[model samples]
Target chain A: DAGITQSPRYKITETGRQVTLMCHQTWSHSYMFWYRQDLGHGLRLIYYSAAADITDKGEVPDGYVVSRSKTENFPLTLESATRSQTSVYFCASSESLWSSGSPLHFGNGTRLTVT
Target chain B: GIQVEQSPPDLILQEGANSTLRCNFSDSVNNLQWFHQNPWGQLINLFYIPSGTKQNGRLSATTVATERYSLLYISSSQTTDSGVYFCAGALYNQGGKLIFGQGTELSVKP
Candidate 1:
């Protein structure tokens, strides 16, 4: 309840269907990020939000979309799920942008499978 | 874009042993962090050492920004330490985007 939480721990969706992964944090961090992990590629950033209404693309933002309407929530959306999009999605948050030596707190992650 | 590389892609050790993991970067970094992903798939922050050395409990980390590398050391390993260890780096002007390494999978057998 005091940390970051991800919903739908596991999800299975068919191709061409839209799926959204939810992330919520109680700390009200200013920076929120979405990352996808695969076997050979480690963790690749999908998107990150500096604050409410300010978002930017990361290393891998091709098919994923993200929005942060509030400081406590950042949601990632897959417009049309594809098999290649199957991976473990993680959500992380930081208190500030300055390198105050603060670490990113991560959620348990959501496993998404596209069939 | 910066590139991150980790050494010893996989490792296995008995309980009470010690191990070291290394992370190398292709360019300068403004921030560096080490994370421990437990067997249950929970990513826990181990350290946020951009430079110099810091120790906590049985874990310690050192980052040489000038050399563009970082090292994580685990002492008295336990079965609970079994998981993947990742190192992420952020460039100075990259807007705090983290580029993660492939990670080292460590298994500690009791």
Candidate 2:
């Protein structure tokens, strides 16, 4: 497809288990981001990648790891999934840093539940 | 870090009515965007208006960076417009870090 896609739209894992959320974009955007959405919190950024091999933490990065080995893919890993991490995860991509009229395109999102 | 706040946490309107959503920021921002999270949990970009105004179909947005706020207007609301509207801003020195507001949840009834 020509848009961003997320894998395992729904996932249920036990606490302390490891889970990985995959995000792939066909546009080859330079900037990719992962966000978690809960009831009161609209969306909190967990991690973002500027380009291949360059990533940084966002507002909420604890217990999460992200890697961008290619321009088209960015994956988020939860080393030890906790019940607190049970939320909807969204992946988005932009052509560049936000200065150049680049609006983020988001995937359908992954709903993860930790029990 | 910049703080973002949105007004009217929840709203319900009859179809064909009009509504407006507002976003306030604590500091200067270099990037501002509006998104609509559909009922299916898909976030669709509505606008990337860091400044000035832009319109698309029944939706329009205006960002007054000097005022540290933005407004999104939905004209003749439809059932499809029922969703969570979010506004996000990125600070000047920050490396593409977006701070999202609490969001306005809108429900358009027929």
User: Listing every candidate in turn, what is its Cα RMSD in Å to the true structure after a full C-alpha superposition?
Assistant: 1.1, 1.1
Model 1: per-residue Cα lDDT over B1-110, one tens digit each: 89999999999999999999999999978889999998888899899888899999999999999999999999999999899999998886888688899999999999
Clashes of each: 0, 0
TM-score of 2: 0.97
lDDT of 1 by residue, A29-110 (tens): 9899999999988899999988999999999999888888899999999999999999999999998645755789999999
DockQ of each: 0.74, 0.77
Model 2: lDDT of residue A35: 96
- Tens-digit per-residue lDDT, A1-115, candidate 2: 5999999999999999999999999998988999999999989999988899999999999999998989999999999999999999999999965564678899999999999
Task: Judge candidate 1 at residue B100 and give its lDDT.
Answer: 91
lDDT against the true structure, each candidate: 0.92, 0.93
Name the runs in model 2 displaced over 4 angstroms.
A99-101
Off by over 4 Å in 1: none
Minimal lDDT window, size 10, model 1 chain A: A95-104
